[model samples]
Target chain A: MSSERIITVRALTRVEGEGALHVRLDGDEVEDVRLSIYEAPRFFEAFLRERSIEDVPDLTARICGICPVAYQMSSVHALEAALGITITPTIRRLRRLMYCGEWIESHSLHVFLLHAADFFGCASGIELARQFPQQVNDGLQIKQAGNALLEVLGGRAIHPVNVRIGGFHRLPAAGELTALLPKLREARSAAIAAADWIAEFEFPACEFECEWVALTHPDEYPMNAGLIGSTRFPAIEVDEFEDHFEETQVHHSTALHATRRERQTPYLLGPLSRLNLNRDRLRKPAREIAQRLLPQRVIHNRFLSIAARLVEIVHCLDEAIESIQDYRAEGEASCRYAARSGRGCAATEAPRGTLYHAYEISDDGRVRRAKIVPPTSQNQRQIETDLAHFLPAVLDQPDDQIALSCEKLIRSYDPCISCSTHFLKLTMERR
Target chain B: MNTHSRITAVLGLGSPHGDDQFGWSVVDALTHCRRALPSIHVRLVKLRHPIDVISWINDQTQVHLIDAAVGCPIDQVLRLRCKVPTEWRTIECLPAKGTHDLSLGTVLGTAESLDKPIESVTLWLGPAQQCSPIQLMSARTAEAVDACARKLEQTIRGAGPLADPNSHLTPQSVPPSARAGAVTRAEDFDGEMPDSRIDLER
Candidate 1:
């Protein structure tokens, strides 16, 4: 029998981007666990400096192929704040509708293709498809519906070219928007079924009392814009984000780990946090689904995140239908703005979590400085913390099973390491 | 059957990473010559995940995947026929070096299980020498991109008269090299190709 052992998973599967897990064990006691993010830095912030402010939306959207709209939305909102431009109600509606497309597409992908495999005891979607053909087919169809919605509004699904600083470069014609209703209606049923399916899965027994943070809005479930709120802290304005949260560099990872400045502790974000923070704001169908599946107003189970994502998909589909029904194409696609020398910050809930962007623009329209705090970076510390708490229970299990459980926990966050470090290589060892 | 009637799909599976972009460039080149080639119905798709090609396989008779593979000699391009699996099982195949977690064989296996298998599948692989984070495409990969495109066009044109363009091909009848088993390099093709030992379906 080994006295001391190290378990490392070289490349974790299913999740977007690359990352590894390292666990040091002494006899039956878990000594240390580190979720090291080895993705290479792409210097996005440094590249943003001196670039034209007008080009920010398209340029920043390249950060994550999975959630390009999130990057575009956060960047545009920050630049608009700097320029002191208020878009019209119609433009706002269109932006929200676009955001709905992203949420539905991204959430569906995570639930069906990525996270669902773990529950079925499969390594990838291919394995899951072999066992549950109908389920995988339904998931693929649901994903297609989401992609179709994106194509209608954004021209192309991945790295959409239609979004601009003030608004979309070209708004979907009324007929174009109306045509998507039938598919969305069908997808609503599929999403509801997905929620129920995931709810039936046997989840691991684990809970951690940590700070749950997300954007909160009075009238709607936050997406495009909102005040940042945490279970422990009051809501703060977008501009006050840097004042409350700080990003610190760690030696093991290329991505910066974020923490609440005052408490200096990790906080949770993403679907679970968002749902916990704003369950009441969900629309009728989604609210009912959440009530049936979750029951509790505040959920602490990380594994129930798949259920949360499905509910959010239902909400987004319903919201998109409503927005399209109320659409009137009266305003210009984008509002014109002149460059001004000022600093601006804005936060929007990316599919993974709250994505914050801040920019200082020069009078000549060039970017003087830029800061982008992706949700993955914000959740890194919390992920590490979760791993530390999670390892103790699984220490007695076989090495492979323990590694699988750890991978599942990390995937629950749906962490998009690509958005932060731009790369990931996973390694696991036992000695 | 009209010799001109056949559905051919060229899928580019890659990211914006250096040399990885070679696949996209090959597809782009094929698309540029779309109008000149009236005999073939060409559909082009850019994919982030290898599994995404599964959806595009349903209606097409033949699918050509162009991607960058590690271990191949620099500036060299290799054409290999992919072996589609007959029995459905969990795909535990390892992906090519520098590729995503899911391998192309696993995706094809999953597609077959879903009853959407394509009759003929080919891989036009360019050697990936430089695959850094920020770099777009290495000069060697850039050169191989156009050459691979031209070779693909030549092969499609030389594939002889179509035998029942609309007929569904049984798995056993697929050419020996393109049959459902193991990926094998084209023995009779030109170019300085190295012995390939990468197991696509494990």
Candidate 2:
């Protein structure tokens, strides 16, 4: 019998947050594969125990610098639901547009800066620029355009200052939105061009057959709001999340690893999952591109995720342009929500995947408890399984090549552990 | 053509691993004077890569590329102009070479080869006291921040960029009166010192 060998990868690079990999080979038979996360969890739930409901947005925004809007959107929606308030159509469209901007920005950054570096043989974006200046510029420009959308809709890029549970604090002027038309048009073309560009790069042969889960919408392409389900499962409202899923702090990773309630195995979420699960949900140019380009309908194959993400970029651009044309500036930016004690839960399709946020609030509208399950944490097991299974076949390859493939596979999920759990809101009163 | 464009530019550089931000902090000193320079069509670029001074620039246009440069036993800032007569437009130690990037570089280089004029350039290098992923710069290199700031101020008054090499160098040169925690280089202390050299200056 051969000796068992354990190969471990520490501090995975390029993905949004942090995680590690451990592989144990028992005489060639894989014994264990763990995609461990060690990033310090802020325990926002514990911290939110006594915070006013109004502070939920601000507090959640601190959870991630990348997807603050996702958190904000869900949190406000949850609060509105608990308070028995409903927003107008204009606010909803605006919110959707803002979320679209996030999808564009986050996707661009991950695709061009983080993931592309792995394909191009660089440790970081700073390293990638030496070889390709215009590509970098194009990427950054796309990113800036997205950021511009966020700035106009929300307040800033990092921690957006606008938005509240009832509605927005202030709406954009007609001219401000009109000015974005040209940029949005340019972005629409760029998104398609970018999709074409990255699709041509040779992706490694990688695919997974595990269960894929994400939010699904009837009309929209599942952003900021949706019903959670998997390719093998039925759609369920946000309230049913805990009934079907479980999140536990595992020994391998710092982030709370999640799995199905009855099963011991982990599942996949995020772009690949959402794209594959909701392929029929996509509208127009995005749908056309996906139909023409995406490699089959398997989300398990990590490489296909690039095509999936590009398709998403195009979808966001088309949606944004359409939303911009129909935007009207006269709705109450927010509804005055009165604080009340209630158990609130929400599910929104973050740029990464289906993100769930739950809070138990006090009578004064203060949060008594909070719980969040990010997409990456749920897909951790799948990541390790992919790595463990793929390594032996390519063991003889150069280290750089192996590392590149591994990093690319990891980035394909767009693992946003922190931003996956964040949100942003503001208010003038204590509640 | 009787008229010639006197081009001027500024670049910001640093290793994501080092407190290389100081190299470009000079802009803060000149934010008050931006309009004065823009009237003449001066371009100011924010560069995160250390060695791309040649490729991202017009070889004939005067340039100022700032970054944490590797060299000198003690930490100190230095300013170097393109003195390499041949292939002056080519940057040193490029890190990435993907097909798309290579094509992009080729395009830029071809543009230069077609007489795009790329010779006049300056690099204001902020020395890394230590290059460790989590290490801080040497005391001497940290000290050069003030001197570099002052030097940049003086140069901006001349309506152009300037470099003062060795402004931050050895610890022995650091005055006893000054302290480590006081300067912008505190990040040097916060980050881990890297044993491996950052390659290709991407």
Candidate 3:
């Protein structure tokens, strides 16, 4: 004889956007798991059709408030590639600095506010703050420092208006860039403290075998552009992304799940993947911290992602300060370019993971086609796969406990449901 | 009262979509009517999200937050004076569905938790229906925006609350003596007002 029970979390809390989780089990055997993203499909692709190429950066920046820089960087790079425009070295350095701000802002928010509470068994960051006020305050200060950089460079913190297809509408004055150094330096100390603090959390001893994918740059940690590499494959250019990977629609989600085309296997992205691929490229301070904390070529435990995020935050602050100290006005705010019919695609490492943008532009400077693959969608299938492996151990607990455990696992990925299909709810079933 | 001693920040929180732009419209109206309240040094900030309020109101002693509210009547205004951390959680005007999951109320709670130097907060809310197609405010919403903005101007001037029995700005608009201190519930003032707290963080 067999008994059946079902567990459901009507709405998930603490993560960005909306989403839900469901698991079905039969007599202690995990049958199926689903990370359903019900957030309505924002037809940004269709919206870009026939729009001016100049509008691409600002328009795509609207996709996610938390990681707008990711969208802006990817769109501008892809459009520049399409128009065959090359940016100056100074402009390239400034763009990297802007990305550093975003990574700091985003990673700090996730590590302290979103994921930290899960470790302490608290329901929300506010709850965790009651016990660790100083830590929470430090986190907010670190996040504010990042926002300071974004405000100066990107125009406004959320959905920056300064970025254009070629470069920027205006370059921030040298004083404006230098003024942020004090706060950024403070934030650097906070990030290091944060990494040390998070390293103490007892990460659940659950490891899974998975392929990690990220952009690989020879010189520095990859932020803007590089060869797309995965643990399973050597490398592929951004143009060959579609050939190697494909997105497929699943019945339960509005977000399309992405998998490697040849192996038809799920892949993971975000800080863990970035650290595994580019650990040696990290700045000395961050690399030293990573060595002390992780000391592994590859980490399979998803929960240690918070550690990776803090380490990256340290690296970003260091890079941002260096870029500001070496600042110059250069020749022009932007590179001059002519619109031509061409197809181009580019990928950048978003705070969350790799963000890929491809565009087909006409001779008239209008967008003919557009495709954007946010990292959350690429990791959706892998999230479900992780749950299947993660659920059996927690299945003996009450439904609510199981639900909370599942949410903890999901939050480790820091899935932005709004960026993917949009929202989340969780449910579990037994038969 | 010396207005300069009290630095006030007037924050209009809105996205540029349909009626949702009420917060921005109010800030714009306030900026245009600055001459009327010359005695006060008010910082008028237009913000896209409530979380931004944390950074925008860094040194402000008093803050007036105006935004479009769902679940209320179209033309009516809901007012709340936030004095404590818990008061912010009860005022259910902000949405938590987006990527930035921090609602206005949650952000206020967070602000207090982070020990931000915000002494007092007064919220002016007008009803909202749409959020898309960009920058198109309904006529009713526009009227509500002006009324809310005028009320804020009067508040900034340190003028005592004025009574208008026919006004949709009710309860708190009457007087502090007549209503409960700061935390005025819509149900306490008008029977027709929908319990606007229905959609709060479920």
Candidate 4:
């Protein structure tokens, strides 16, 4: 007689957006695993059709509230590429600064409010806060600093209005940028403390034989611009993305799953991937913090993603402070560009991972076609792969503990199902 | 009343879809009418998610939250005064599912667990207008927006609850007629209200 069991979580809590995990087991042997993302399709690609190239930044920003800057940045870069517009160094630096704000806020929110509870054996951040109020407060303060930066740069934190195709509608005054320095300085300390605090958490020991992919720059850590590279593949230009990767419609999920076209295998893309590929590119304090937290240099344990996120937060804060301190307003807020018939693609490092945006604009500046491969969709296959590799070790644990661990593993990726979902109810079955 | 510890925060939680924009519309209306209440310092926050209310209420003693309550009568306005739980162990009521998963009640419950506990919380809720094409508020929901703002003003002024016999109004007393048609067009509110609706097929 074959023994069988089933576990189901109707709604996954703590993580942004909705999704579910289903695992099948026959006795002690794992049969199958799936991360079904049921977030409703927003038809963003279709919506972009016939829309003016200028509206791309603002429209795509709504894809995910947590990482709107990522969308805006990716869209603008793609549109600029199509229009043959090159923004000044000032605009580029400011774009990086804006991205830093997103990374800080998003990483802090995930590390403290979302993923911290998993390590502490709590159900939610609310439960974690009850035990560690000071930690939660510190996290909130750090998040606020990031939000303050967003408000200063983009005008609002959630969906910023300042981002434009060639540049910005307005540049921050030197005084305005200077005022944020002190707060960022304070936040830098807070982020450092946070990194120290999260470094102490006991992470589960697990490693995968999967490809790690991220945007790689020559001089600095990838944020606004870089070439897509992975341990398995050579650096590829943005336009070569669809040639290397393919998004397929899976029956179980509303989100389209992405894979490397050559191998049709799962690849990891996120903090772990970024940190693994661009560890040397991180700035001073962040580099120091990364060394302290991840002495091994390459993190194989997926659970230690919280540590990577903390390291990135430190990096972003440091970068933000430096950017603000060296603030210089030069030239027009945005350069003039004429939209012509062309195909353009851009890949940028979102808070989660690399976000790829491709657009074909008509001669009249209207968007003819658009394709967006969000990080979560790209990570979906890898998530399922991780689960298949991860569950075998914890098969003997209590079912509830197993479920909790599964949720933790998923959240470790900081999957923004809100962007990919058109969403999770976890279910486990043993037969 | 010590002004330092007393933070009167008004959070309008809504999306940019039809009547769901009630909370945001009400707050927009209050911004124009805020000059009338000079004695109290009110912090107005426009939020897309209910969980955001937690961050907005930091160190705030009195908080007024406005949101659209779906399934309620089209023109009805529901106001409830909430009690902040002092202890983490005490399980406060969670928010009902509104436009988002993290409801106002859930945020407040989470907020109560934090170090800062709000003393008084008033929720101003109006009917969610169900309409296709998703642009502005319906004429009915527009009226509810104005009434919601007026109620907030009245509450801020400490007008002793403005006794009302309406059944929809709870925790605070306001006249039945006070919940009448108070509306504003979406065009009147500045800033883009992006439609948050997604086409989902199960």
Candidate 5:
């Protein structure tokens, strides 16, 4: 009989916020593991109670600087639903383009800076650059192309100021699209090259059983719009999401933990989920790339999550350029929205995974009730599951090495703890 | 990458947390004096780890690093302008590699590593009291940010292109408006609220 050993990583690296890991071992038998969140939660929902809906996008963007696009998209979409307004086709496309930019920016940053750092045995992206300057430069330029897309489409790249309830505050002229052609072309090559490069990375063979879920659309890879669901069921509508899933709140985090209602377990969401659930929906070119890179099958190997992200980045860049080329300035900048009493739910694919927000707004437009479930929340349980399973196999590795491996596992999801909790606590007493 | 040159780089740090964004508050406080000076081409670079400093810089020409240091006193912001008079030492990179994967400090380290000619580099670290992983800044940090911005403007009034580690150069006043297009813009990116805004509550 083999004896078990245990190790713990007090904190993880290559991620947005802070988290620690704990494991139990018995004679080489992996037992229990808990991924603990140490970062303080900023009560975004609580602080948002009295604020005007107009400010919600900017405020919520603070949830995760990395995934600002997701927060803005979710909050804005909810507001649009609550106000009962239909935005223009151009506006819809514009939002999608902005989302594409975000995905590209985030995914490229992760592949080069976080995940690749792990495979290359480097402390960080900066360290990785020393060994490979051109690779780092390419990654940066790729990131810049994504940022440039956001800058032109959404105004400022990070926490863009242009996206509004109806459409952009000011739409760029057609000329702007041409200016991006050269860069987009360069980024296209970079994305493909990056995918090929990452494909060459050594991946540990490990797999787990968790439900894969994401938004699915009939026409294209789901981004700004979709119905909530997983490979487990026909795609469920957004409002029905509550019926299919549940979030358990605890003192450990301001964000709640989410589990599928049917399975009472954490369902997979994010790049891998979307890729597996909607592989066919990717645009023809993107589909061709995916076909070359990924065989037609469900990838449960956690390390392949990086591959999924690269494929998605390529998908977004292609769409971003196409959307910009098709952008027109004819539509009214915005539509009038009146306050109404109703419940609204909206979901968007953040760089990491799925982000959902539901709000109850009064006739006067004040938020009556709010529930935000960031992608990271849904994956927290899954990460814990992976740790529990992984501990037994890698018990002999150095503690730091083990911790880094675990960090890579988590980072594969690109957890944005900052996005998961957006509110800051005042912590004051009248006394 | 020149790992040998002691080039100086200046980084202006501020927090978007609450009003702590006021670290950029001095944007408007300093009056524009020399609007005619042509904009200079800076190797605007960012990196995640201090180790990459040598490669990105190729060769250093006075590098600058800017960021908000957490837990600082408000309105009493200090901009420590000094040259790291020693050879490049390996420094640990900040977590999240900084908000942008492209951190100013990381780039400099790369420049120095490649044997670039970086005469001197400066870090503009504003204090952020809460210093929570989130960007939210404490009240004191906000005030300090504004004070620091103002002080930066004052210091630059006679500060010329800093080339030597010990040279005392006069600042050539450039009108803020002329400094507009991306350059001379603060990394903190504080200024008037955007002229155009989307009605977020559609």
Candidate 6:
């Protein structure tokens, strides 16, 4: 008779928000794995109803402190689509610049502070800093450069008060944009070095088949606007997102787990997904690094996502510098639009992954309904599936070792539990 | 680039809501009193997260951190002068919870780990209750905030010779009257100090 064992992590640390993981095992066989997101539903979507359409961007921006710009971008773009407003070319470039700041800040924090410690077996980011003070300092400086960009562009670093429905409430001065050039240049160089350094770290050998999903743009790497592109399909309009994808409420988690309607299986998103779908659109330096380090056209190794984040960091810094150099206050700060009843949807590539927002505006410009699908929620199901596949090899180890391995895998996804319930304690049972 | 400069940063950590706003109120008071002591180069910064204290610590040799503490008797002010910054977790008055995962303890630990240029750390904590998220600050907490601010103001005023890079301004550096009610650590308290890791979830 095989013995029954269960491993449970009551509360997971080092990740954002509250969550737990449970694994059930019978002898050598993996019975079940669940990434339980226990945080209460924040009801952002429900509360957004009946609010004025103009307030959607600001209101939604409060959803997540770490990725406020992404929320603002998705909400504003979706609202603009609903209002039928075409932003000017300069406004579009500025939006991209704001996104560059967000990506650099969010990705840098995850790469160095949250995720890197796992690779070194360090207990915390502080422990990692103790050993690699220079790396941690570099990361903080890079993050500060991003924060400076955000403060200048969006009016504040966290939950920017400047973003409006059509465009910015105020434009940055040329000097303000020019001032960021030196910092952005330094960050780009640091990011390139970090990427090369991370690439040399030994990743745990594991790969599982899952569809890669991301927003794809023809002219540039996707940020503000794009069509939904996946490895299994060509491309679909943001309007067609619901027709292809579905978010289902799982019993174990408060967050809605996403899946393809056709297959009803977990798919992947985030840095790896974006890299796989849009590698060619990367900025020249990022592309060169990606080519040299990651030569493969499609990267299935989820652990390499850290490397992907660093690559994107380098890319965003380069993009930010270029945008600042070419910036000008052209036309009006915002586009002119009138209120009318319409529905629109938009997807922007957030630091973690694609963030989709759909809004229905009343003729009087009040929001009738709001649906926001944060990247963390979309990735939750895939995390469970990945854990199930990845746990078998480490099953022979002690329960604590197994739990640590599971935590390492989950952190690799950098699941923001707070965002996902809009979503790991780990439990392993052997029978 | 003078690494030896004596820059004293008084960082007030608090949220905008209810008694949690105690730190901000004290900082606001100090900002008003700043002009009175123009000779002292004390920088006052209001922060929402403890980790943000790191950014201001880079150039400063001496630092004062002000925050509100729950689970203690209201109107009482607690002070801890960190001789060893990494032992911040030993303070029972510290609200173990952080803005996300970065608590004051964690921030102090990180600062020590990074070896930031700092000479001394004085943490001033005011007793807080009813830290309601959206409600205005409680009256008692506001009174406590004022008292703490006055004490800090006197201490900052007494910290002279701002031009001297080697000079340090700790709470003990001032006269006994400036730190009359301040306790050295949780162990010295006449009353029972709660666990340092006060699980807020409970």
Against the hidden reference, what TM-scores do the models get?
0.88, 0.72, 0.91, 0.88, 0.81, 0.87
Ranking of all predicted structures according to lDDT, beginning with the best and ending with the worst: 3, 6, 4, 1, 5, 2
The native-contact fractions of the candidates, in order shown, are 0.27, 0.00, 0.46, 0.19, 0.08, 0.31
Query: lDDT tens digits, residues B11-75, model 5?
Result: 33333544334323333332232242122422333222232333333244544444454322233
Q: Highest lDDT: give the candidate number.
A: 3
Best by TM-score: 3
Mind giving the per-residue lDDT tens digits that candidate 5 earns over A1-431?
55444344543555666555556555555555655565666777887886777778887876766777888899889888878888888878878888888888888777776677778888755577777666666776777788878778767665677877767688777788668878987988887777667767788877876789888887879987888767767788888888988988755555567888777787778888998988988876677777876658887888888888888878887887787677667767777777777878898888778888888887777887778888888888887787677656765777666666666777777777666552111111110
Off by over 4 Å in 2: A4-12, A117-136, A296-298, A396-403, A417-431, B1-202
- Tell me how far the alpha carbon of residue A423 in candidate 6 is from the true structure, in angstroms, after superposition: 11
Model 3 C-alpha lDDT per residue in residues B23-64, reported as the tens digit of each score: 889999989999887545778877765666776545545788
Residues A195-306 of candidate 3 have per-residue lDDT tens digits of 6677789999779989999999999999998999888788999999999999999998889999999889999999999999999999999998898778577889999898
TM-score of model 2 vs. true structure: 0.72
Ranking by TM-score: 3, 4, 1, 6, 5, 2
lDDT of each: 0.74, 0.61, 0.79, 0.76, 0.62, 0.76
Per-residue accuracy of model 2 over A84-160 as CA lDDT, tens digit each: 78888888889888888888888877776667766666765656656555666566566667777988988755567
Candidate 3 chain A, poorest ten consecutive residues by summed lDDT: A417-426
TM-score (0 to 1) for chain A, all models? 0.96, 0.91, 0.98, 0.98, 0.92, 0.98
The worst-scoring run of ten residues by lDDT in candidate 4 chain B lies at B180-189
- Candidate 2 chain A — worst ten consecutive residues by lDDT sum? A422-431
Q: Can you tell me which runs of candidate 1 are displaced by over 4 Å?
A: A26-29, A422-431, B1-7, B60-62, B73-75, B82-100, B154-202
Docking class of 6: acceptable
Give the CA lDDT, 0 to 100, for residue A231 in model 4: 80
Give one digit per residue, the lDDT tens place, for model 2 in B31-132. 555755544645555433222343445544656655554432234454433433222222232211111122112323333433434434444545455543
Candidate 5, residue A198: Cα displacement in angstroms equals: 2.1
- Report the CAPRI category for model 5: incorrect
